[model samples]
Target: MPRSIRRRPGLAAALALLAAAAPAATAQQVVIYRCTDASGALTVQNDEPCPAGSREERAIIEPPPPMPVYVPQAPAPAPVTSRATQAAAATTPAVPERPEAPAPARIADADRLPPPPIFRCHTPGNDRYISEDAEPKPRCVPLQTVGINGDPSLGAGAACEWQYDRCERIPDGEACDGWRQRGREIESTWRYARGDARAPLQDAFARVSTILSDTTCGLPPG
Candidate 1:
């Protein structure tokens, strides 16, 4: 049985260079020479350039990475001081230290987890919409339309009714699904949306983004 030989640093470095030059397709094999060193001691030598007789091919040993040679950095030069005038900074007799302006109040981002609830709402004519408000008050709607004569003034037919929009808190799962979906949609449309259309999307994106920042929302997975 051929034994694997652990060599010195010099040998290891040489082997590493030789292995690097070898074709990548070469099998992880190296020829090992068993012989006597110049000292005449029985030993397995790795530095031998060639085998004298029957050669043993052993698995190539991986060499450690080269150790970095560190040269100690020179100490910095000492700064020269001028003794021209060592007097205390000229003092203004009545000078008073100005009070530091109170630090500007820190505004916190809405990073609350399990985001605030979103509600689905609709006003009279089955016109549906979503809202964050729980109990929204009804609004007045003019029931009259333009007159046949184009006069537009409704003398006797003028009427109005209070429209109560229906609303319900959607499931958390459903709300979260919609929030993530809307975020993706907003990102998709970001390049195209312009002027008026972009403003509302910006607001909507802000709400969705708040949830996106929370890891518990399961977005952008850990």
Candidate 2:
């Protein structure tokens, strides 16, 4: 304690010297000037007045200000929803009812009939009669209706054959000529046929009409 107290005065003296030296250092650091003399000789000095303005240049150096530092803050957290809010959302009104779709159209069942039996009957004169009715004769046999949908060529040939049969049935004169002319007319339509059943069916029925027209055969009303 005694030695520390003795050193205090020396420390105080040193601090006083530093304080006095501060102003002297500041004065030394002032702007410097370059002055030209009467003989055009240049002289450089610190903080002194130029001699009668022969020419003077002063340079002051100062340090630039320090840049400011920026620190980014974190974003605030999102608010949490309470359980009551979730329950209220769940209790909202139910969605509007959707309209019912229209019922599908009801389809009517097809009107059905049993197919008529076709019979083949033979006469005593060795002639054969193909009938659509059930003949009680011993030589009569049932036959199925022929389907001509498979081959269009076969259908056309059958149509021509039916026409010839009709021509044979008619009297061999102007009446048969009429039937022949009808055949020729129907044959002309064959050129325009477009792979349909109508043309051949039409020709076959036209021939069948002559046979059905004969009243002497005692056939039922066509």
Candidate 3:
């Protein structure tokens, strides 16, 4: 017998066994339908036939597309510096720092003390010294230096007495007026005197007045 005729009975027997084993295959299958109603409203349904006045539209079953795969790109390479550029940077000179200023000189406390009174001797071998004592030395005339205490007449009592004697010798005239005028001028300048040296000037003016008074020279009006 031909091969087709011989396989017919076996194929029919296999189909019969499958139908018997799976009687509810049609009920288990899912079908989706798209339909339009009388009012032209479209509806989609699962496992239900279209209504009497509605038309059925074609439906299809499609496999879902594959999920996308994420690919990580390689990291960018680091920037490269040329040898010439690196050499230029290495050869650059750093700025020089400024020199600091020297500190100011400090003033000594001893330097601020008042100057000592100066004494001198007019004798050929006598040397000057700073002392307050004005006693006459042997063969030496004691003299107070000028501008030491702003009074040149200080420590010169002998000289002042000698001047007074000379004034006594002169008759009372323009000569006597000159001496009186000098005393008045000294007195006038003393009125405006100030500071620690002021007392010495005042004392000097008093000495001048006393000399004039002793010699009978006229005194200026107050």
Candidate 4:
């Protein structure tokens, strides 16, 4: 074994030289930093290139997270109606409502009803005014030979002859416009002449007479 080692001496020497060179080639160089802390203490360090008695600070760099993308939604459609067409709809007629009938007039007592014919006014040589309320006068000469008739001619020896003429066309009397009328005036005068001093009855009679005259005689020509 001694003789074999003596034979490999050159190789052994070269191996030793490689070992020494390997350490020199692989030796890491270090950079150092020095700084002062909040406590006013100085520090310096080696290894990761930091100040002594201080830890090396490494950068914690990281990429930002991805951003969010929004997608737009479409609005819902409106409903459609299947009604009548425009031209036919426009030409269609609207229905009319029927009118209501008027109520019938009510009649009171038949016995107290006024006569159909009313008195008229006309001037002749001798004039006679007759009222429906006239009574048989004790002094009125009821001549047995004389006669009274509804006529215009005043016959000889005639007791009474009725004359017919259109009553005066009084304003507001042609169409009843309340109480102001000629017939009412004449009635009020006659009521006073009869010595009936009852005011309310006289006024009532006047109003009724005015109404009746307008209803019956108002149809005379106009």
Candidate 5:
């Protein structure tokens, strides 16, 4: 017996549409079967074959390829070349650039202020002290000797000259701290002094207070 070849054109088209809309997880292709009974009535169904003794046809429907997903790639690290190493890296692929981070704000030291000046003083008698006065008054010490020419109290004399002292600019932090300490000491003394002595204490306190409040000593600006 000769097998009748029949095809329902719409069935293949419909199955193809379904295959395209199918989930990507479905890896199997769509198979459509066409069937005809002995009475010559035609039927079409997916994934079903004709009954025994009936003519049949098969059609395959393939799903459309999935679109490729996009992903960002990081820049390649720089390679260093050496005289003893393998072939030196000549060139590398260009990579997408990233935004640069913002730089911190800054102000020059000269623009803001100069550090407070402090002097380290040493006296002839082995006494040491620090001075903040820009124009220090002349310090004079009397010449004294325990013995001269076998005399117990040989000679004593007075002389006047400006003492030499080492001066340096202190860091802003240290200067700020020094000014604060000085302010505290000035306030303590101001509370104890009275009448003529009160005037000098007030002046000293005001000077240190200004230094403390206005300078950052080398600290970054907020």
Candidate 6:
């Protein structure tokens, strides 16, 4: 016997009821608007109106990008070159320019000049002597030999003594004509008197003056 086709009426009717049920549409929801004015002041109202003097730009939310699949690249080959080429490639990178050093200081010679020459005479003489180094005795001598005069002995001692005495009375404001210098010492015989009376002393002063001026004569006793 063939299997009879089984059909349930009640099950078919329940399926029809389920197919007839329909969902209702939700009411158009009013969106309360909120915005800021051009001066950045906040504004809120029930009705939708574009904010005054401010353009409205739509705000967008972005999703993050997907993670990338990593694929390793092949290693680069080492470079091969001639020695000259390698040397050119090996040049050091340029360095930043540095400020120039200040110029070396220059010192003036006046700052290190030597002191002036110092010279002082040291000899044995009072205010009268030219310096400390001068002969002590009066420079006078008697003329031993008579000149073309009639007699040498006649006017000899008296005239000689008178002439030499002039040394005791050296004339004021009269400078001696001759002077002798030996090393730092000076010696000189000045005319004490005029006329024949002082002839001997004058002759003596002349001799002493000569010795003083002589380069060969050494410094005499003070």
User: Which candidate comes out best when scored by lDDT?
Assistant: 5
The pairs that clash in candidate 2 are none
What lDDT tens digits, residue by residue, belong to model 6 across residues 78-114? 8878999878768966442322223322433333222
lDDT of 2 by residue, 98-124 (tens): 222233223222322222233344454
Across residues 1-222, which tens digit of lDDT does each residue of candidate 5 receive? 555555567667766677666656555677777788897777786777788887788989777666566788998988866855543334544342322222323555555564476544445556645458644566664444545575646655544555654444445446665565556666666666767887777777666655544445544555
Task: Rank by TM-score, highest first.
Answer: 5, 1, 3, 4, 2, 6
Q: Is candidate 4 or candidate 5 better by TM-score?
A: 5
Q: Give TM per candidate.
A: 0.34, 0.17, 0.21, 0.19, 0.34, 0.15
Candidate 1 lDDT over 1-222, as tens digits, reads 344444545556657766574544442444445544434433444645434443443334544444456789999997755554323333335342221222322334343357567677777677766666767887887876656776567445767788788888878867776556656666556546766876676666665666655534544444
Instruction: Tell me the deviation in Å of residue 137 in model 2.
Output: 99
lDDT of 2 at 162: 14
RMSD of each: 27.8, 31.1, 35.7, 36.7, 23.5, 40.5
Residue-level lDDT tens digits of model 3 in 66-122? 345578999999789999988988998654222222233343443332222222223
Clashes of 6: 8
Model 2 weakest lDDT span, ten residues long: 159-168
Q: How many clashes show up per model?
A: 0, 0, 0, 4, 2, 8
Query: Comparing candidate 2 with candidate 5, which one achieves the higher lDDT?
Result: 5
Candidate lDDT values, in order: 0.57, 0.43, 0.46, 0.39, 0.60, 0.36
Between candidates 3 and 4, the lDDT winner: 3
Q: What is the lDDT, from 0 to 100, of the residue 114 in candidate 4? A: 29
